[model samples]
Target: MTKRPPALVAIVIYKTFSALLLVVMAIALGLTVKKHQLLVDFSESYALEGKLQIIKWTLKEILNLNPKTLQFTSMAVGLYAIVTAIEGIGLWYQKAWAKILVLVLVGISIPPEIFELIRRMSLLKLAVFLVNLAVFWYLLRHSLSTRDDNQLQ
Candidate 1:
């Protein structure tokens, strides 16, 4: 078995975590929509008792969501989450296709990230952009190295 690279492991962990969060959010939102009355009742009770004002606001926001719109949003997030998960798994296995996928996906996003930074520069934004660029570079460089290693063998 090939030893997994630390970078690949880190990417897999990050992607899996993000996918998990998105999936959880989608499920929570779906359930909240399905049990809208329950959430509304709880929110009303909280407001009447003047307890956990923040929760009341949050519940109100959630309760106000249109089920159709919520479903669409949830589905979109779920799909992206699935894609991220697949990429992570592929990277973990050091698949050549995964490297290309990572490079293309990350490369495509570079423009948007740069635009965001140009629109409003922030430390967090810069860090995210740099990390994404690094990931792309890593994938490209490592893929070449692995290809060369295979050829030598």
Candidate 2:
């Protein structure tokens, strides 16, 4: 097998990390269904009562969600996690489909990211958008370079 590029390796690592976080989020959301008090206790334990606005907001939103909604969200998050893991694995193996998949997904997400940034400028959102943009650019460049190399051979 040919050696993988450093940028591809970095992207794979990012995907893996994202997948792991999504899996944890899915499990947490699933467990919290119909457990509003437990979530409150968790927030208290973490001293998130009024410390972080984002954390408080997130907990409030989650608490407001019905059990059924939470279940559905959990399933969706889990599915996304699975997809992300697959992307990372495929990229690690240098699969063309994975490159295309990441490119398309990242490309699709850029618009919403821009809208979100426009609605509310936040450091985290900006960082995420920038990182995703970089990932897309690098993957596109890599794909083009590989195609050109193939044509030359």
Candidate of highest lDDT: 2
The 10-residue segment with the lowest total lDDT in model 2: 41-50
- Worst-scoring 10-residue span by lDDT in model 1: 43-52
What's the number of clashes in each of the models? 0, 0
Give the alpha carbon lDDT tens digit for every residue of 1-153 in model 1.
999889888777876787798888888767776887777777666345756678767876777888787778778877877888888888888778878887898899999999999999999999889988888887888888988999999
Clashing pairs in 2: none
lDDT of each: 0.82, 0.92
lDDT of 1 at 20: 90
Indicate the residue-level lDDT of 91 in model 2: 97
Candidate 1 lDDT score relative to the true structure? 0.82
